[model samples]
Target: MPLPPDIRHGGNKACYSPMLDYVKLPTPEAFESSEDYYSTTFHEMIHSTGHASRVGRKGILEPSYFGSHEYSKEELVAEMGAAFLCGYAGIEQRTIGNSAAYIAGWLKALKNDKTLLIHAAAQAQHASDYILNRKRGEGEQIDEPIA
Candidate 1:
């Protein structure tokens, strides 16, 4: 399925701008592989779900300092959400290692807090579900907290 019209590409950096209600991604050729391109696009798309007009997650809506807990948590949500979307689309294997490494970096910055990881996973699931047109109760949950 194609992304919503509000999401667009063509930017030096990949980001979801809530103020603009849009997502801007770098060119596909900028990534190491097509999988990387899609994964990065998916990450930004996940960020868009936090817009007040969508799922309304505060992490993306509020101002947050770089490296702050809120910022780190949002990064976790975006990466994990993208990973979930990739897995659902059956492209996860191509990007799983990179996704794991990307997520691990954030985990380290967050001091390896298992509880935060769990919360982020839950939020990511919610965000992915939102993007995929799955209502909260319409499908099986896509992410389970790590034991």
Candidate 2:
């Protein structure tokens, strides 16, 4: 499938603003390669999924300091979600190592908490499902409880 229209634009950095419900991304040339640019954009797009209108993950809804536990966990969710999307889209190898290394840094800072990793991965899956327009289960009609 094609990228969401709003995510295909240009800038010098990529970010998701929950208040705006849109992703801002740098130009493809700004990154080492187009694949890297798409990878970063996918990360921000995952962040966008946490908006109140979507998956409604608390980290995006509530304010948290940059490096705080909540913020770090949210970062994990975005990275893992992006990695999952990349894999599903058949571009995983192009960015998996980089994504893994980035995720590892957050894991280290979180004190190597395996439980946190599990929770983040599950949230990531949900976010991926949301982006792909998948429902939690047939007729479930409710958000998955946040981890």
TM-scores for all candidates? 0.85, 0.87
lDDT of 2: 0.81
CA lDDT, candidate 1, residue 30: 82
Best model number under TM-score: 2
The per-model lDDT (C-alpha) reads 0.81, 0.81
Q: Which ten residues in a row have the lowest lDDT in candidate 1?
A: 138-147
Candidate 2 lDDT by residue in tens digits, 96-146 = 899999999888779856699889998899888878877767876535546
lDDT of 1: 0.81
Question: Over all chains combined, what TM-score does candidate 1 have?
Answer: 0.85
